[model samples]
Structure formats: structure tokens, C-alpha cells
Target chain A: MKLAHIQQILQAEVLTGAGSLDREVGMAFSADLISDILVMCKEHTLLLTGMTHIQIVKTAEICDLAAVVFVRGKRPGPEAIALAAQNDIPLLLSSLTMYESAGLLYCAGLPGISRNPDPCGRAKGERTG
Target chain B: MSEQAKPEQILILEFTLKSLDFMRAGEASSEFKQRLKKLGFKPELVRRAAIAAYEAEMNVIIHARKGVMRFEIAPARLLIVVEDEGPGISDIEQAMQEGFTTASAAIRELGFGAGMGLPNIKRCADAMDIQSIPGQGTRLQIIINNE
Candidate 1:
């Protein structure tokens, strides 16, 4: 799913990277813990979380995520917003709870990151796309 | 700085991991990922290196009082060594297991200390060597072969 689609589906407010709304997201993962996202999320994923800190932006960079969506109507501090802008990561805000946000995306056909091997037998976390 | 004949080398990056610095926990690892990308490493290798470095850096910031993380790059190998001068792990074997973390509730709230740090580092690196002394510190030497 494209980030723009996610924004529309969640009625999310763009907090940063207004220019990157069209970026493609290969997968989706939702977690409030930066480390969980860091360890479990794959590249080009739309990460949904309530963790509003610069480390979230930093985690997106490390994990090669597509963008971050702050769930439960949470908003990041100015420093985090600035960091996201500086790093060119799209940040969004949604009023939906984490469970609701993830459910909507999964119902929309966006898969989450999987630790299981791919159908093609590729190793775990390998990007099939 | 070496008088002896030495092969042409790449960059050596160093970063300090501050203890409980929640605001900037992943700073060094983020920069390390960029460096590997700018060097044109393969995407898989870059991701592995980035994950290793990030996990290792987080380990120090969460577990130690202070630490230094150094990256030594060469044509065929990338070496990352993080040394922390904080309380060391008493059970190295236990620490190497996934989901065996000793992180406080505060750290867990930040989405860390899930006991995945050392295990993930070991998974990402081609080879790893760890040295630790209870009440002293811990050191991790991680190598990922660029070739």
C-alpha cells in the first residue's frame, strides 16, 4: 500500500514529509516499542506506533521503514518532528488505536513483517518484493 | 600513523553511547547505517551491519554507564567493537538467548531490553567475540565480511 492510501484509510494527519505521501510501503507493522519495531519490522514498512520520540525517527532510518504513523491521536514533540524532517522520514498522526490501525491495514491487504520463511523459501526478513 | 607498509583502508568511525540517554539512544547506529550506505555496501550487508551496530549500541546505552563504539572498515571486512564501562553480564550464555533481557521496566517501555540485543547481534555478524567481567564492563567485537 502507498503511504497516501494509509493516510486516507486512517484519516491521518501528516506531521512531516508532506512531499512523500506517495511513497510505496511494502509492509506494515504496529508497535509502541522502538526496539520491537527495530527488530521485527522490515524495509519500506509503514510503522504504526504511539512512541513519539526522535528515536522513532532514528529507528525508521535504521530499519529502512517507509514512514511512521503515531497512533491513538498521539503527536510527536517538536524535536522528533524536526528530526523526521531532517532525516526525510514521513511522520503521520492517527486517532485510531494501535489495534484498529493495524486491523484496517491488514484488511486492506497490506501484510505485516513475518519471521517465518517466505513461500519461495527465502530466509526470514528477506524482502520478497 | 603506521610506519610499516599498510593496505589502503576505508573510514574509521567512533561514537560514544551515553547511559540512559533516552533522547538520543539510537543516534550512533543511525549514523553508522548512513555511512555503510554511502560506501555502497550491498543492501543485505548494509542492513546486517546496521542491525548489528544498532543493537550493540542500544545494549550499551541501556545496560552500561558509558561506552565507546568504534567501526573499523576495510575492503573485505567491516569491524564493529562496542566497549562499555558499566555493570557486566554475569551469564553470557543466558544473555545470548533471545527473550532473556534484564532491562528495567523503564527500558522495556521504550521498546528495548527484550533480551534480543546480543542474540540479534550474533545473527547479523559473520563472527562475534564477547568479553565481559561482572561489575567491570562488556565488550563486543562484531565482524561482517564485505566480501
Candidate 2:
């Protein structure tokens, strides 16, 4: 889905990267735990979380995520927004609670990327850098 | 491939840990990951490097008075050296135990005080070595295979 559509559906405020609103997102995940995010998120996925911190932006950068949506009107500090800008990761703030935001995205046909059925399964596509 | 003709390139970054400035903590790791990407490191390796380095960075910020990180890169491996003058860990064994943490409530609220930093480091690095003295300092050497 396009980022602009996501913003409209969730009623989110785009804090940065407004020009990238037409970018497409392939999947979504809702969590504040960095470890789980590291293991589960796919490239270009939308991140929904309640935690507002610089590390969240850093994590998004490392994982190459498309954007972040802050739940429950949580305002990420300036440092977080600055880091997001530097990394070219879009940052959005949503007044909706985490469950409602995630449900909205899910109901809109955005599915979470499931890990391979086998814990040791290898990814079946070209490796990315 | 001509091994003798290729020059080794080393990328180094140094960051100061401001004792209680939680907001600026992950800047170094973010820069480090960017460097790794510019070098064409695989995503899996990049993920491992970022997780290990970020965890170590957080440790220094929450537990140490000051810290420095040095990274060396080659076609075959990535070496990360993290040194800190923080109150050294009293027990490496206990510290390596998953879910063991001395992080404050404030750190926990940031989502990392889960006591999984060291273990996560071990899980990500191909070879890991840590040396610490209770009152002196701590040094960690982590080697990650580029394969």
C-alpha cells in the first residue's frame, strides 16, 4: 500500500519524508521489542509501535524498514525525528492505540510476513545487502 | 581474484557515551550500520553486526562512565572492538546468562533492559572475547564472518 493511503486510514501525522508518501509498503509489524523486530521484519515493512525512542529509528534503519507509525499519540523526540530524517525512514504519529492501528492495517489487506515454517529454512530469493 | 593487489580498507568510528543521555545513545550504531551497507555487506551479516554493536553500545551507555568502539573490515571478516571504563562486570558468566540485567527502570522502559544484550552479542558474533576487571574496565572483541 502507498504511504499516503496508510496516513489517511490511520489518521497519522507525517513528521518527516512527506515526499516519500507514494512509496509502497509490502508488510507490517507491531511491536516495540527490537530483538523480535530484528528477527521478523522484512524490507519495506511498516513498523507500528508505542515506544518512542532513538533506538527505534536506528533499528528501522538497520532493518531497512519503510516507515514507522507511533501509536496512541506518542510523540517521538526531536532526536528520533532527526535520526529518521538522516536515515530517510519515514516517521508518522498516530493517535490510535496499537491494537486499533494494527487492526486497521490488517483489515486493509496488509499481512505480516511470517517466518519460514521451518525454523532453519533459508530465504528463497536473492540475498539483499 | 588477485589477492596481493587488493588493499585492505579499515573503517573506524569513535563515540563518547554521555553518562545519562539516553536520547543520543544509538547514534554510533546507526552510523556503523550505514558504513556496513556502503561496503556491500550482506543483509544477514549487517543485521548481526547491528544487533551486536547496538547491544554493546547500550551496555556502555547504561553501565559505563565512557566507551569507545572501533571497527575493522576485510573481505572475509568484520572485527568490532568495544572498550569501556564503566564499572566492570563482576561476573562474566552471570552477565552472559540470558535475562540477567542490572539496567535501571529508565533503561528498561526503552525496551532493552531485558538483560539479553550480552547473550544477543554472543548469538550474533562468530567469535567473542570479553575481559573485565571489577573496578578497572571492560574490553570486548567480536569477530563476524562475512560469509
Best by lDDT: 1
**Which CAPRI level is candidate 2?**
acceptable
**What's the TM-score, to 2 decimals, of chain B in model 2?**
0.90
Please give the TM-score that candidate 1 achieves against the real structure.
0.90
* Global CA lDDT computed for model 2: 0.82
User: For model 2, how does the per-residue alpha-carbon lDDT over B1-147 read when each residue is reduced to its tens digit?
Assistant: 001223566555666665666777777777778778888999878878987888788788888888787777677888888898978989999999977888888777777677777888898899999999998889998899987
Top candidate, metric DockQ: 1
Against the true structure, candidate 2 reaches a TM-score of 0.83
Clash-forming residue pairs, model 2: B64-B86
lDDT of 1 by residue, A34-117 (tens): 657756777788889988867788878888888999999999899999988988899999999999998777766677787322
For every prediction, compared with the true complex, DockQ reads 0.57, 0.41
Interface RMSD of each: 1.6, 2.1
What's model 1's lDDT at A125?
A: 46
